[model samples]
Target: MENKDSKSEMIKSMAFRLFLDRGYDATTIRMLSRAAGVEAPSIYHYFGSKKGLFYAISESYLEDYQELLKESMKHWGADPMNQILGFVKFAVWYTMNHIDETKFYLRYRLFWPAELSEDMEKHFHKTNDQKEDLLRDAIRVCIETGSCKVDEQTAYRSLINFVDSCTFNIIFSNWRPDEQELIETWQLFYQSRIKLGKGDFEL
Candidate 1:
């Protein structure tokens, strides 16, 4: 028998694919059970309800994403500038490898549907609090180091807007940027936006 963790993972993985392929409202509990290879009640056992499962999926993806961000920070430890660059790298890698998750994530962020329960919406926002806190600290450090001239609000909004736009050509349109091209594009954005002290910044 699969371990409890593996079983739960199977359920989440199937549910995510199914939800994206078929609209959430159209995905019945029975369909989820068939797709995940779990009994219908098992879904309820592991996740309170479909809404609860959605929350679980979002939480799982973001946790992995945040970990990637943290790992990228280890490249050149202790520098505030490295911290933000880590995220830029993470964004590029995530876009290339995690197309499905990225599409789902952008969907919710850009076009939050009415189908989402209020609790699910709040849970989504709450999960990112820690990651955002980390970035804010790094941005502050960049300011202190004279690497980022923008104020906190401008820097934060610019980053958010930056990610939103990154998905445009890659996710929503026909443009398929190779990994290297994506990296250079992000490098340019950061360099231009922050006016990098290291004039020829290359990530």
Candidate 2:
């Protein structure tokens, strides 16, 4: 059973790398089998189809991301701004640490197989809604406490867009800011928007 689990994980890891490097449409079962040192039939036996393998990889990655987000939120204190900063720090650190998975998610997230796209969309929406709600609640607290000057909705949207774009550039583009540099840059921007006094909350 242990050997079987190891072999299955090996296949998934190899397939994930291939999909990251060569993309989903260009990757084939023969290539995956060769990379994983498994028979072609084993791929089908394990994953049923190429789409099944991709879905499994994507789901696993998203699950990891969700856990990281949840864990980050647990460390938040009374300050909503601190909570937001904590979330961003975890996000940036995760992207830098898991560049391959981040690249895979960015590249193939919207290009899933037709049969799976609708289901994937629903799953993604559900996951995103949870994150959105968390951010919205934090932003609301910031507004209520007079720490943030922007409206809750606008602040939430802007922060999400800014973080997503910055992280995407850090992963996919030539930008290679270190973890501290990324965190500090975001902290500066966020502090400028809010009414927080200097040294109130360290990023």
- Per-residue lDDT of model 2, residues 34-153, tens digit only: 999999888888888988888788888889888888877788776877888877777777887888877777776657756566776775775688778878988898898787887877
Top lDDT: which candidate number? 2
Which runs of model 1 end up more than 4 angstroms from their true locations? 1-6, 113-115, 174-184, 196-203
**Candidate 1 per-residue lDDT over residues 127-181, each given as its tens digit:** 4686588678988988887878778877777776676576555566755667687
How do the predictions measure up, each by TM-score?
0.77, 0.82
Each prediction's whole-model lDDT (CA): 0.75, 0.78
Model 1 has an lDDT value of 0.75
Cα shift from native, residue 122, model 1 (Å): 3.1
Number of backbone-clashing residue pairs for each candidate, in the order shown? 0, 0
